[model samples]
Target: MKVEWKGVMPAVTTKFNEDDTLDLIMFAKNIRAQIDAGVHGIVLGGSLGEASTLLAEEKNVLIRETVQLSEGKIPVVMTIAEQATKVAIAAASDAHENGADALMILPPMRYKSTDIETVQYFKDIASSTDLPIMIYNNPVDYKIEVTVDMFEELLELDNITAVKESTRDIINIGRLRNRFGERLSILTGVDPLALESLFMGADGWVAGLVCAFPEETVAIYELAKAGRPKEATEIYRWFLPLLELDISPQLVQNIKLAEVATGIGTETVRKPRLNLSGDERKRVLKVIEEGLKTRPILPDYKSF
Candidate 1:
């Protein structure tokens, strides 16, 4: 399916049972709400989804369930990340077979990785399935830099049609748009940088916080796409802090807390990634309260 690189694409959180099992019921409801909110697409099991902690079967199951709930109303993009080429390919293919519209793959995490190695890892995944591929480069999370040449090479692979540049380097985004021009769709993953990416020639936003406030995120993207930067910037100013919340040390905890606050998904993140404590919890809640009070969900679309 050809995706519209226009509005926001929420990387929907993977809800889990108290026993740390996949909660398909809430996940399906979240998927339905994204569709109702009129988002461009639904990104399942991505960064906000805590893809790292989920088992392969759980990941596969989540994607399959998302496909079923989506009911072809929206494109389903799965974040399939791995250090092994074969495993990444297998994951991408699995996502595609289970009805994912696209597969976003992160660079293979390595101790001392090179651009050549990163490009090859993606190529390995690209050759596996016909799904449109979006490159995920979150240097903060993955701890690797994707050189411009690596991006250029990745673009040569036709299936590699988009990128989720989660780095602070907005210049690299402009460089890619300058070189590749219309060949690829660049989607910003870093929520705060979404405005910068849109201004610099990105086609869309693959937002993590969108799970908490899809309506606002979608509104911002729509305004940006329609060339209303002034209004979009106003919305972004309100969202900047919320975007920064994902980078918090208690990232998963903050994110889940915010989602629960907004009445989206549960605050149940798996272990090894613990929930926030004392001062950290208070700080996170404070940020959420301030963001909500100031922005206030547009007075409508608040029921979600």
Candidate 2:
């Protein structure tokens, strides 16, 4: 299947019951809600989904349920960020078989000596599947960062077609985009820089914030695509504070809270990846409350 990678692809949250099990029902509801709100794409098992916290089977189940819920209307993109190429390859195949439209692979995190294991890991998985792969290059959580040169080399693989650049450096993204041009679909993973990236010529956004605020994120992409920079800028400004929260240590928790606050999804998450508690959550919740008070022109998201 030729998956068109563009527009809003929320790094969706994996809903968990209070007992720490995957909440497939709430998760499917969230996916259906985003699709109804008009997001162009959906990334099932990314960082925001708490990939590290989920078991392999749990992630597999999440992909399967997401594919079932999407029901072929939007593309289902899942992450395979394991350090071992074999694991990554296996997950990619699972995603493909389970109905994912594309796979997003990131550089390995453990044993960061920058060995051939690093580059060849990507090569091994890229060659393992016919599914179109988009490399996710985020430097913060993962120790190894794929450089433009390294990524360009990986592009020699036929299946490697797109990338989700989740760094703050617009200059780096611009440089990569200028060099690769049409050969790569550059999607910014950070919501704060998403608008800037669109203007800088990125093809899409793989965002976590969009899970709760789909209307605003989609609007940002549309207005920018329609050449309405002023309107997009205003929208971006209104959500900038909330966008900052998406990158914090509390991102996964905060997104679910925002979703619950908006009555779209649950705030429940797994124990190892617990939701905010006590004082910290109180302070963070205050930001959401205050942001809600300041009216920003956005879509009226209906309860699903």
Candidate 3:
């Protein structure tokens, strides 16, 4: 269950019942779909997984359940997105105890820490645990960018082994590859940029849209890796609209609706976040329905 930091690693959504309780049954169902579709790993409590509303112990439960469901076939990574370094470190420790194979950690939430502080934050968390860590570097949305200079300092820790590159700056992938070589693994965190990122030398994808469209997502990665761009572009062009849904402020609700459309999950979300409604709901549904209507017959990309 060692995290390879390569291939399609889903930043999966959290399923909830009408009463706002954890829907382990539905959660497992969606994860099973990802595993069957040939994902490399599954990430729990990510931004797409509604990490902000999740309780500490609840995360442990998720890690334990996902570990059980994956059954050692793939790695189960827990995301630590906390405002306090202490809390982030504790969460990382707890994930270690609960069988998480690795962790995806964000910069200090809410407060925009300086580059030095951010580097120290990640360093402290990595020092606190033995598990490998994937630094979530999304300055576009999270406001604290883990720049290449900062990464130079962070990579001093052996456990800081990978990065979830979400800066939307495609060139950063090449920068990381050129600077780090094989010292760090670069996994694209942006869905719309996934195919391009792979072509730009990313090792994998930390995907959001794959929660519903796992097979198509994996197909793009595999085909691109196999040097079959003609086949991969055909699907990536068709998948662009759906992939765009993962970049929004309401990505959690949007992706949940996609899951429901694919018949793999429910639409219940935590408070402060409701299901899509009005024109937004109709628009998202239109996109989902149209994608399903024309869902491509995937080639034998797996065989390659």
Any idea what lDDT model 1 has?
A: 0.78
Global lDDT scores for all candidate models: 0.78, 0.81, 0.92
Taking the tens digit of each residue's C-alpha lDDT, what string does model 3 give over 166-208? Answer: 9999999999999999999999999999999999999999999
> For model 3, which pairs clash?
none
Mind sharing the TM-score for model 2?
0.93
Per-residue lDDT value at 161 in model 3: 92
TM-score of each: 0.92, 0.93, 0.98
Q: Largest lDDT belongs to which candidate?
A: 3
lDDT of 2 by residue, 1-30 (tens): 578778788889888877788887788877
lDDT of 1 by residue, 1-304 (tens): 7865545788777798999898888877777777777787888777544787988888778878877877777788888767688877788777877778888788875554777887778887898777888888778777877766787888778788887887878897888888788787788877767888888888888877877887788777777777778877888899989988866556667777888888878888888787778987888899999998897445232232
In model 2, the runs with Cα more than 4 Å from the true position are 113-115, 299-304
Return whichever of 1 and 3 wins on TM-score. Answer: 3
251 in model 2: Cα distance from truth in Å? 0.8
Compare candidates 1 and 2 on TM-score and give the better one: 2
